[model samples]
Target: MKTIVFKALPFDKTLLTLALESGVDAVLTSADKVEAVRALGRVRVLTPEELPSLALDSKTDEEEAVRRLKAGEQLALAKGWEIIPVENILAQVPDVALEVESLDRARLAAGILERGADVLVVLPEAAKELKAIVREVKLSQGTIPLVPAVVTEIRHAGLGHRVCVDTISMLKRGQGMLVGDSSAFTFLVHAETESNPYVAARPFRVNAGAVHAYCSLPGDKTCYLEELSAGRDVLVVDASGETSIATVGRLKVEVRPMLLITAKAGERTGHVFLQNAETIRLTKPGGEPVSVVTLREGDEVLVRTDEAGRHFGMRIREDIKEG
Candidate 1:
């Protein structure tokens, strides 16, 4: 459905493959020859300048720069890909510390939609507000994935003011998992933390029937980093109740909109407070008042979150779309 173009040196074989396998629609450039573009689609251009380099090149910085660019052009020609001269996309960067109050997050989100940014990154402190803004953007505009940052340190114990973190142990080690139920509903959660106390604990079984949608990440990737890079709005649920749904943490993400939403048993309780990068709403259907921003009567909303752990919800106003 999408096409990705790369401008890497011939030597950057690893980078090319990484892009292709990692959900890139197509791989172009980074080869010895260049080609033409056909049917302009979602194009992702990766450059070596943005990525860190190893100690293989010459000590001189100039030599390395020239070598990388030349290799990039060669790779482009070999792959029959278009070479975009300008660079607008960036990767694996730190969170930008912009005040959401100072600028209308909704307005900025609109601009991001216009600019066609692959992802929108917001500070953890302003994640809740950003989630609301993102929801607005998606409702008005098309689906633009949002990745919110959790700009804080990780604490080992006590569950003090921490975002729900996904771990590899949960995913692979059999403690927990990022799985969907037989109905094909998915969620990101810890087995011990979110599971139903009534059921007998299984090795890899996740109690998805209790929760609507959940996801889980490995230990190496923290909650903050996951949400920002994740392509959708992230939902942050506070089991500790130490932090309000409004308060922002490190990273937050919303799941993709295409995914289905099924009702779970426990998501509607007063204890289950959720803040999506797109909107603050409980994951349950026909919910009580936890003050969640939901689509009321034909209102459209945009929801975005990737495997990273970030999410966004956008409420689409029909009036605006009609105008």
Candidate 2:
């Protein structure tokens, strides 16, 4: 079993699911506890003091600092986690002149790399500089994973959307990497691509697809469905919360503000088709009969079902309805 290092527990269920699917062998514990080793299967725990080459700068908003630390702890709890003591990790790192700006981050990151740091932590503000250092190490024919410390917020829990995008971007560096965050699970549902060339080092797979997808079609991503035609897979996701429908298959594509439904028309009457001059409806317990609207000659409607409940007919209206 290969060893994988992490600075925090994977709080985001999506990323956690992806990591499990991708075959990561172990998680670096925050406590550096022996029990974590047994729990993670193939594991080796390291303390932060073990590395001497790296340093950490404690400069940031108090709220952000606490947020990042909590995220790390949450990651540990999700996986068999232990602490990587700062003292131990830094001791083994080959000491270098500390830069005034990122003196601490450089030391910590460099120390971990020298001491086999599979996943090194960096402050969010230092993310750009961390990337630069990773590049330098790669130039020397070295490969190491530099994990960023992201400060999460209630508005954007689980590191929200940006972190996943960042992880995908870093995978292009071709190094064994892991992201430790409380919110890593958020994007797991919607991030669908496995083994993306963008980040080939660690091809992580999450159970969920990313709410946002890379659109091959032109124009702003928000307008992807505006000009598209119907009867194809128009993937739509909920960027709002955990409870909402994460992804819904848009059945058809027509003129602006119009749609066609293609999935199951109803649960009792699986796969009903509707093509009318104006509107269509489905008959289901507690379900609104009129499922679609604005149907001209060649329009379609799709319905989907989930564990929560059954959904009927797709909305093909041209006008945006008020919330």
Candidate 3:
């Protein structure tokens, strides 16, 4: 994940306050204004003396930047830097920082060479779109490649312990967690963001599935639903595969009738045991939540499939199989 640092030098009070309120990772301010920023809010403050900004104009400057980085200098590439030069530096250096004045440049910096810069130094002039930039870079873990998997079967699985994940952040209709019997083929279990005559919308909850199901987490990891607890972070994904991090407020486990859902993506087949209730839903292709009771065989729904090998939730290279 890229940490965003807002440049607040030649300090403007409004910009500094906005950065703090917008959840900036750190504030880059002057030595004199360090205390001022600290007084305003609690944030990691960086001074020019500690973290210097460099402009890459010529070959010598690039070399100097690399040399300084090798010598353990905290640095950032100033704005107006070309892509080739950044790629050259990035090829040699890992986790370099870059200054971006807008959301577009920030996106470019974050996607440079696929594994882009680690830190985005947000310029002060970008105050208006600061929240959007931060959300897209920090929260939206880019986009995950989603595919439509045809439902092959759905059957009653009798009574079982189910888990309802209540996150601190409210979710939208198409957003939920990805979980399944295997990490390789996870279903887009729709959040409780839709309402019915019998139940109010639970925008903060996802009636996830069976307690033993595999739930996706950040950093490409998966964990059983039973392992989740309050304050832990989970990956909240949308039907379109855009992801955001949500903190678990609490876990609600109860005895509920379960339904086993089986679907196939390519040659890979996967399953998820969700609660057999009309309120429990899965996402459709067009970003709508369709109830499991209404979901029939041959109905297409969105799912995510990856190479399936996990050891203690971390991905590994091994021939592992799950139903």
Deviating ranges (above 4 Å) for candidate 1: 1-6, 20-26, 30-116, 119-189, 192-205, 210-323
Q: Over the stretch 165-206, how does candidate 3's per-residue lDDT look in tens digits?
A: 999998988999998988889999999998899999999999
> What is every candidate's alpha-carbon RMSD to the true fold?
18.7, 20.8, 1.6
Residue range 1-323, candidate 1, lDDT tens digits: 01122333443444444433333333334323223211233444433333333232223533443455445422111111111211111111111111122125424423432442232222233333433443343322232222111111111121112133322222222122222222112223322222234533332222221233233222111232233332322233222211111112223233322212222222210111133212222221111211123323222111223222223312222332100
Query: TM-score, each model?
Result: 0.22, 0.18, 0.95
For candidate 1, the per-residue lDDT at 50 reads 34
List, residue by residue over 1-323, the lDDT tens digit for candidate 2: 01233332323334333333333343333454546444534444444333212223332322332344444421111111112543342343332122212424443434443443333332223333533443332112222111111112111113212111212221111111111111111111223222334443222211111122121111101212122233322222212111110122232322222122222222211121122212122212221122233222222222222111111212233333210
Steric collisions counted per model: 62, 69, 0
Error of 1 at 41 (Å): 19
* Candidate 3 off by > 4 Å: none
How would the candidate models be sorted by TM-score, starting from the highest? 3, 1, 2
TM-score of 2: 0.18
User: By lDDT, is 2 or 3 better?
Assistant: 3
Q: How many steric clashes does model 2 contain? A: 69
